[model samples]
Target chain A: MKRAFIPLLILGALAVVSAWLALSFGSVNTPWQTVWQVISGNERGLPFDLVLQLRLPRAINAFTTGALLALAGALMQVLLRNPLADPYVLGISGGAAVAALCALLLGIGGLWLNAAAFAGALISMLIVFGLARGAGAWSASRLLLTGVIVASGWGAVIGFLLTVSPDAQLRGMLFWLMGDLGSATQYGVGVVTLVLGLGLSLPLARNLNVMARGELTARALGVPVARLRLGLYVLASLLTAVAVMTAGSIGFIGLVAPHVLRLAVGNDHRILLPGAALFGGSLLLLADTVARTALAPQQLPVGVVTALLGVPVFLYLLSRAERR
Target chain B: MSVQIPIIETRDLNLSIADKAICRNLNLRVNPTERWGLLGVNGVGKTSLLLALAGLKIPQAGSVHLQGRALSELSGRQIAQICGVMFQDSDDAFPVSVLETALIGRHPYLHAWAWESAADEAIARAALQAVNLSDCAHRMTNSLSGGERRRLALAALLAQDPTLMLLDEPVNHLDLHHQIDVLELLTQQVAQHGKAAVMVLHDVNLAMRYCDHVMMLFGYGEVLQGPVQEVLTLDNLSRLYGHPVRSVETPEGCLFYPGKT
Candidate 1:
């Protein structure tokens, strides 16, 4: 209990600092007092608009997207009982990328792209689920292999679409592929908040706990194993789709956040889920801040920054787990 | 025994795998208060029969009934509620705690939205205590020894509190003391709770000593099912194991020994 409480406190402090830094420090460099006043409904002119309209939404988007992806990744790993499993392993991000690319090439704009991404993710998940089931039962190995096959297939399709796309839109597609948080808006942030908050909170947590036990044991214990697995895949795909649509394909947050949290805490989903969410959100917010300020007037894509930061941390964690 | 409906019954059951016949024309009826030992050599379809009984595998030719209702008519959850099964091996090599593993036994009783209630926790705790693993409740399962893992699996089955328990090689990795302890506990459960238990035992002596009834399967899909003494005779044992066997009766119980003719 003592150990558990200390990490929580540290995480809480980190979350606060990350949120504050994200809100106060940006390209315009709004003062803390003005940022506070703007947040408190006082008008502070153009700087306030940049703070409230641009930075605040961007920060929230980074936070929620990271948290959602990480939680989805953790849930997938537990459900599939494979350490390598993640949101992308199930072709969710690939499906969403294909949909987004299609929208870009065909000149589709606005919410339709997000909707198409969600639909593509759902369809891809269903196909994986179908391939995973044989003789009315699901095998984890089969599910994983199916995910890999479908993801590569979708990747090829996405590549074909990019090849045929117009040159003017090609640069945007490349930027989206690498992932950028510049397009995050209040509307996108709201969607991410609603979906990630409600989708991954309680039921998924319990289901994941049941799933961590082997499937046969879970079935004997009264868990509807097949149904629960299907539900988790769909929910994870939805959450990943939301993140993919909002921030493009921000890579390792999903893989790294949950793993780091799992190392700190054990594999209990109730703790791992919420902890992963908070840490992932904070990590992504910090990464976004670094990306924004690292090179003045030439912001690096948030995805590149996350990958650069996450790889070393992931290696350290792996060695630490190995030593233990 | 007072007249109560049989908890599990299989009639002329035929099961096959990949077009190879495993068990054919096998019939079994287990009273609600009986503890039956299923004994056979390795690869004699012991695990397959247990799977069929647990509703995990479908029979090719016959039907299995639980309390006079066809098992096929019941949902998996309903079957799970009435029958607890401990498989030979589970792939849960992760660091799930013993308490968490045992709590999964309460899954049949819990609603999709409801958390584990206090009553559920109490049941799980009692099951752990029964297996002498209460001290290790919060310990990670992967850290447990082989014997401890087997006992923990037994504890998980006990936590289910099912009317019928079907265990496939429940004592596989257990030491001598734990094997006796688990079998004694099962005996007490049958005597006190009137619950039925069907377990596959590799050790014939252990089966004969603790089991009230025994089912011995031989080659060519033949099974001898009756009271332990009648079904576990030296002649039947010799035929089943394809060896000469001798039985010695002592004050404790009967013991079988392999011999050359």
Candidate 2:
């Protein structure tokens, strides 16, 4: 636990640096000195306003959104008892995308759209839980199969929604689907959700550790298996919904962060959960930085940057592990 | 010892799977200091009986009493504190260290939301040490060899330190040396701690060596339970297995194996 702290501290440093870089460079570039001046309250005007008001909050939002999504992913993997399970594995983003696109097609925008998306995500979660947990001795594979089928169903619905939408609205919906931090201006809700998610998840890490063994083992060990599972399901859903509500549907960080962290620090959830959170936040912020500056005038969605940056790094890590 | 309640008692019990009755009108008592070996052919519901005894499943009829209280009346945690179950197989999806896996045995004792204390760690360490897995405490469970994993599972159950143990094929997948090692450990547990255990065993010779009582499933929901000496007859064994099995009078007692057609 203590050894993991050093890497976590380094990741914390990287998170700070990513924030600084996010604020200092973008469409309208500002020097590091000016970013400092704005923070110290020694400077005012365009550079100061951009750093403090716009980029700073957005960067914080990016960090927490990634943190929440990664935490959700890590929790879902444990809940499903499958290493490949991700936040979106249970059709979360698919549900959200369908609702958000439907709202856009019907001329709904802003908070109403966000509300529909979150509602859809919750609905998908409940549906998967209900369908997968019926009657028989419920296996995690059964749960995963139900979620996968529901996700595929949601994917079809999302595709249909996309095909019918007018051309002019397509770009915005696509950006939403691919994930965008451009509209991630609210830091308060995201920050609170991240804190709450981690605060609650840390204590349950022990429960989750036993859970990772197997459901039967967990039950035999005296952990409240059903209640623990319910708590994890709700927690993972809320974290996913919050992340989606904050930044659309960022990908890769949720899937890759925990795996990488697990590969690095043994699978003790006490360390794995927090490691996922910090590393996830850093990875997303770094990706968002690249997203904002890679094309300069035309900003790419953070989701694209995440997949691009996360895949090669993950593949290399996988190869290295295989070699060992 | 004169005034004692059986660690586990099942009365008028019926068990089935998907409408096929496996056992019926079964009454059993496993007392502390008595090690029970359940002998039956595959699909005769040996594992099912064990699961029901462990409170993981409901009997089709009647009730199970743990330490004189109805199993249903006790909370899962209370049941777990009194009884530990070792499953036959597990398809683990995530990786955890061997020590962490063993620490799960301490779950019933720890307070809600509290981490394992130093004493719990010490106990877990001792359990692993007993299984000869102290060296693999930090190794990933998925990375351990088959015998090592099985022993680790046993170690976890040992760490639970339950009064009654329900083990399904506890000696499965063990090498010859480890098989004797594990059975000896289990016998020591019963003799030293007075913990009652019922195990589903495929090896009749092992049962002859270790068990104080025996239960043989006689198909069609019939069973006979009594002292090992009285219950472990070749005729009953052949009938239970639906094959010709014979026993030889060796120095170590009756050695049972499949006879000629």
Question: In TM-score terms, which candidate is top?
Answer: 2
Model 2, docking class: medium
lDDT of 1 by residue, B123-233 (tens): 999999999999999988777888888888888888888899998888889888988999999999988998999999988888888888998866456778999868888
The DockQ of each candidate is 0.43, 0.57
TM-score to native of every candidate shown: 0.89, 0.95
lDDT of 2 by residue, A1-324 (tens): 455578778777877888888889888889898889899999988888788888888789888988998899899999888776789988877777888888889988877888888888888888888898887556677878888899999999988988988899999999999899887656888899889999999888877888888877887777788788889888998999888877788888998998888787767787788878888888888888888888888899999999988889889988997786
Candidate 2, which segments miss by more than 4 Å at Cα? A1-4, A28-37, A40-42, A133-137
Residue-by-residue lDDT tens digits, candidate 1, A216-250? 77766666677777777777777787788788888
lDDT tens digits, residue span B1-261, model 2? 387898999999999888877779888988888999998888888988888888887788999999999998998889999999988876567777788788889988876557787888899999999989999999877788888888999999999999998888988999999999999999999999989899999999899898989998866788899998898888888888888988778876778889999
Show pairs that collide, candidate 2: none
* Weakest lDDT window of 10 consecutive positions for candidate 1 chain B: B88-97
How far is B96's C-alpha from truth in model 2 (Å)? Answer: 2.1
Model 2 chain B lDDT-worst window of ten: B88-97
Give the Cα lDDT of each candidate: 0.81, 0.86
